[model samples]
Target: MNFAPTPRTTSLRSPEKLRYDKATAYDVLDAAHICHLGYVHDGTPRVLPTAYARIDDRLYFHGSTGSRAFLSARDEGVEVCATVTIEDGIVFARSWFHHSVNYRCVMAHGRARLVQDPDRRLQALAAMIDTLADGRSADSRPPSAKELAQTAVLELALTEVSVKVRRGGPNDDAEDLSLPHWAGHLPLATVAGEPVPDTGIGVRPPPYLP
Candidate 1:
C-alpha cells in the first residue's frame, strides 16, 4: 500500500526520489540498525542517534527512563521524527558540483508513546535484540525486572512516512563528461568481521551472526 504523503512527509528537494510505497519504507527501515530521532528538548530541537527495530507496523526504540526526549515524547505526546539511511555508494563526478551519494532512506513522523504493558515491552525488547542477529533473543539472558524498570521502550506507528532513494552513476553535465577526471560510483557495503568473544572465548559464534 502507498502511504499518502502529509505535509510533514513531503520532500522538497529531489521530489522525484521520494517513494510512497510501504515496501520501500520497510526495506530501508529493516536494513538499517540505527536511526536518528529528532525531537524537541525544552525549547530547542535535538537529534539523537539510537538503535531501533521494526515489528509489523511499529517502530521501537529504547533509552534510559529518565531521558528527556523520551519523557517528552511519552508523557507530553510531542511530535518526533525518526530517520534511517543506508549508503550504497559514493558517486564521484568530473566536477565537484556533480558529486553525490547513492543511498536509500526513510523518514517517519509521529508521537511516540512508552510501552507500559509488560508483554508488549518484552516483545519490543526481544525484537530489538533479534535484529542484531536472528534467533539472538533466545540465546541471551532476558532482562531482569529491575533493568526493565529502568529502561524505556517507545513505540511509533509506521504512518506519516516517506522513503527516498538515489541510485545510478554521477550526473555530470554534458560539457564536463569529457573532462579527464574519473567519473563513477564506488559501491559500499557493511561486512561483519569475525566475532571477538569475551567470557565465552572458546564458544563458536552463533550461526545467525551475519
Candidate 2:
C-alpha cells in the first residue's frame, strides 16, 4: 500500500516544517537501527528505545507477549508513535545559545496490532536478523514454533508520519549577526570502525564493517 504523510496535531511542529512525505520519511527510517517508540497506557505516557525494520509500508517490531507494552497495546489499541532520528553533524556559532545540531527525524502515529500470522512473523524475524547483523540469519538456526509463540510481533501501518529536519549553520538572532565573530557550523560524523574477527573463523572481514 502506498502511504503519504498525514500530519497529526501532535506531530506537526511549524508551518514551515520540512516535507514529511512518504519518500522523505522512509529514507530516514530505513537507514537507522534504533527507534524511540512512544505510546500511552493507562492515561500515562511511555517511550521505549527499540530496533525496527520497514517491510513495504509497514514497520515491524518484536517483543515478548508478556511485555507490558504490547499487552497494553492489545487491550487498548491506542495510537502508536515511532520516531527514528539520525544526528549527522554538529552546528556551532559564535553565540552559545545559537548552537544546534543537524538531524533528520521521522515521527509516525498509527493503529498498532500484534501480527499473528506464522509466515509474516517469520518474515519479520528474518528482517530483524538480517538488518541488525549481516550473514547471521541464514547462518544461525531457524525460529521454532515455541520460540515464535514466546515472542510477539507488532506492525504499525505507516499512515500518518511527519518528518522534521534541521541542517546547515546555527540560527543566530538578528541582533547577534553582526557581532563580528566567526559564526559558522562545525561538522560532525561517525566513522566506521575496523571490523574484528574471531580467531576460529581464520579469515578477515571484507571491506565492509559488518
By TM-score, the best candidate is 1
Residue runs of model 2 more than 4 Å from their true location after superposition: 1-13, 75-78, 133-136, 197-203, 206-209
Query: Per-residue lDDT of 75-184 in model 1, one digit per residue for the tens?
Result: 65667899998999999999999899999999999998888999999999999998888799999999999999989999999889999999989999999978999899
lDDT of 1 at 166: 93
Instruction: Give the TM-scores of the predictions, in the order they appear.
Output: 0.96, 0.84
Which tens-of-lDDT digit does each residue in 1-210 have in candidate 2?
334544462344454656657787888887887898888878898899987888988998888888777887675464778988989888877689878788888888887788878899888888887776655678679888799888888899887877778889878888888887887776667566767668776467643234
For model 1, how big is the CA root-mean-square deviation? 1.2
Summing lDDT over every window of 10 consecutive residues in candidate 1, give the lowest-scoring window: 69-78
Clashes of 1: 0
